[model samples]
Target: MATSVDKMSTDTQAESIYFLNAGAAQAEQDRLNRQHRLFDDMMQNDLLPPHVASALSALKTPPKILEVATGTAVWLTEVAKTLPLDAEFVGLDYDTTKFPSSLPPNITLRQADMFKPFSGDLLGKFDVVNVRLIIFALKEGQGTDLLLTSVEPPSQAWFRFQDINWRFAKKVGRDMNLPLSMVAYIKEAGCVDCDDKAYPGNSQLYTRGREDWISRTNVHVKALAEQSLRGITSLGGVEGMTTQKEVDELLACFDKEFEDRIVHYLFVRAWGRKPEAD
Candidate 1:
């Protein structure tokens, strides 16, 4: 399908001022794919929550799914493998450059900004929609919203890095507490049974027998920090991080901390159902 470009809304430019570089490079794609795996594992490997699965099963025809801000389209492609062959999937992102060259026959990836209203053809066109990790690009009122480091104690690095990120986020007018606001957004959108759940990304690091989980979590998080360095530095660097050298040094410290410590955070999922047509 062809990509669609809508006319710019007055707030469009502000909404599009993402803190990270939206480039499509092999390394970024690899990191995103691995990140998806890590998050999927954290969520107990269920592509859809039980209730969502039940809802889809009730449909008379094969269900259609949409994933927003679908960088690399990894999740859509993975979930497609679990569903019936005829079930359709669509993935949308502001930048389609990172979408994989190959996809399941049932999947289509398109370029479109989520902050803008979707085209008429895409409106109300799917049975289910998925959005993940789009918080960094959101503004204060938007329903969606990370950082870490190692010099000093790992805890210090973790919280300090978060502080710097919060400052940067405030400067850019983006909300840092996306999970807290999601249910409200859902309710405002007139959806029913709105709720959110948080998944801990501990990867079993604190569990004695889960050394493999620890190793994988460490590797995944470090890749996250490495990928974020350029984007953070590009925004003129946060306080105490005004130069690329400073950010690099901090990242090295974070790497050391990740190597020695059990680092984890929360991944939240929110959902609501639109009332059936009268």
Candidate 2:
């Protein structure tokens, strides 16, 4: 009786790798989160995919769904509402407190550490496991920054990001791991027939006048570097890698890079199935 978190759990090594290497990268990930929010727009525009909607509509017993790090359920609530009864959903995170209290009845949110193995008691089993935005935990040598097809021009934002994210990760002595691996991790935990998707994000559409993703994220990256380095040095945790002035320098460097072009956005989605008899 393994739980969903058992396989996809984020241990201290993983978290440490992310914070250590990514402690310098801020704007990129957060900005990406702000965009392509399908769930956020679901209630308003019925933006969910036709197949997902259809699948949900047919559910007699709500399909059991698991969402990892469901930030605000900006998507979960809509997913739950769109689905038929018996479509049970469980969202987990260390910060489950961030979940909105207005959650639908079919949806259950819990606060738990996902880094460990699963338990049959708490997590029944899942039909579809939805994982988003857990890339920060991958240490390195994962995949390229991200792979996505887009309609945008030759800004090559995605390629540049691949460099930056890996660059920073290497700096912290971590190998970049792709998010898709977590899906395999799920399968090894007894999930059957895992599914994964990497798609283009809605950033280009929303970023028309906002500048290409690289430029946009560059500013945020620089800011994040400055903030994190300053904080680290002030309290000084890992080592001397981060310091007030060092962070400031990193900010300026990123600012200059942003002024140039280095980093972009892409869409990615992955899912897997869990057996009921487990």
Candidate 3:
């Protein structure tokens, strides 16, 4: 029998990945709903500053906003609270588990599947639609994400074996984001403005901000390398499809990828608007 982590990672099949869009949103969601308000302000940092802010300042007033895949709905809602009181806000997602009944009146939460063709009354709407990491969410639980970091020597051996297959997937582009498709989908829905950029966040449990981004990211790099190892072992063992040597090769490759980031670290923060007519 597989452990819980093993079960979570293996339980993810293609079909079930349909409803498994919980992305980095998990961290954000937990932050938003945590019993303390500290997480909301624990920026130790900043917001869409410099580049994005320049564009944001040019936007028309009280524009309508849609935050797709609104998990905890905290990020958008909190930001909305600081908006020009009249700004129209909407949060769209399939799961409403934490949808709050009490929120600023201007903020509206809607249950809509953006993947489908939006019609009639709602066809062409929304001024700003901020979709962050929605692609990673497309297929959640797709693999057996075992974490052998804490496992004993034997399981560690299995983890080392699993890293091989994952390396193969990354090489071809299974990790690529569908920028054009998403842009067209929003455009067809009547959003006139669009921009695609990936600024994967740099997080460090004890460190903070641009100054500490590298240290935080170093931790992340290690974590990713470790994950690749565990994932390879668990998935390949059930089928006898991978070897320990291949796993080491993949781990070494991934470790190098992360090591290079130690000196230079940045994140992508992108957004676009729907022309007023839309």
Candidate 4:
């Protein structure tokens, strides 16, 4: 399929798109893979529910699966391994630099900006569509709303929502947050039987270590802070909230305050199904 950048009303609007950098490309790729593993372990090795899995597996024809912002396509690749031989898997992202050089025969990777409309062929053509960790990238609710509108409603769609919830910790501190606006967005997009479950971040596989875990967790948190700063500044700069330099200083303070403070996050997995046609 032909994937291209989304159209903007003004050139300035088009030039301001920002992607949070987690160090170099390789580091970012590694982070994403680790993230996938963490979530997989947390979810008991099942990405989706048994009902959803059964739905896709029972399809007479080859089921088509689409993953949005599929960085490194790690989640898609793993899910592909459990599917039928004829299953077709597609992963889309704005940058393909991290996509595996070699992919399974059933899997396809494409470079596509999530901010824009999906290619016509991709509209309403998936049995399942998966999206994760995208809240920090788009402006407030813009990204989730846009993504929901762009994709053709599949038989099922699942979203993994993330937020830094310091309230769960014993210590008081600032944390990056994701609001519950996505629940409404899913319903507004005509999804039915919507449901969600929340999980603690520390419950993931990465948190199951001793001294080594502390060191690795520190690195992960620092990278996340940097990424969050970039996202906030990029969107805020467009809206005249703050400049990049100011964001840098504010993030430095945030880092200090966060030091030794109990870190906690909440991830919510939500799913819904499109109504069958009459």
lDDT string, candidate 4, 1-278, tens digits: 22223332233234434445423677678777876765676576778776899998889889899999898999898898888778999999876667888988999987677777899999989999998877545453362221221111211111111112121111122112343555667777899988777665555435445344344544565565566445544443323224677556655655554333334456677778988877
lDDT of 3 at 49: 35
Error of 3 at 211 (Å): 11
lDDT of the structure predicted as candidate 1 = 0.73
Candidates in order, TM-scores: namely 0.87, 0.58, 0.49, 0.69
Each model's Cα RMSD: 3.6, 7.4, 10.1, 10.0
Candidate 4 ranges beyond 4 A from true positions: 1-18, 141-179, 204-216, 230-262
lDDT of 3 by residue, 1-278 (tens): 33653443334322222222333434434434541232223332334334444564567766666787676677677667555788777887655545676788888776555554543545456655666435434432221221212222133333443343334334322323343345555555565455544332333333555445554444444554444344435343223435667556655655544442432223344444545642
Residue pairs in steric clash, candidate 4? 124-152
Candidates arranged by TM-score, highest first: 1, 4, 2, 3
lDDT of 1 by residue, 197-258 (tens): 87877745555636777667677766666666566666666778777788788788777677
Number of clashes found in candidate 2: 20
Q: lDDT of each model, Cα atoms only?
A: 0.73, 0.50, 0.47, 0.61
Regions of candidate 2 where Cα sits further than 4 Å from its true position: 1-16, 20-33, 36-53, 84-87, 96-107, 118-120, 139-175, 180-195, 201-241, 253-265, 275-278
Model 2 CA lDDT for position 67: 77
Which scores better on lDDT, 3 or 4? 4
Models ranked on lDDT: 1, 4, 2, 3
TM-score, candidate 1, is 0.87
As for TM-score, the candidate ahead, 2 or 4, is 4
Q: Compared to the true structure, candidate 3 yields what TM-score?
A: 0.49
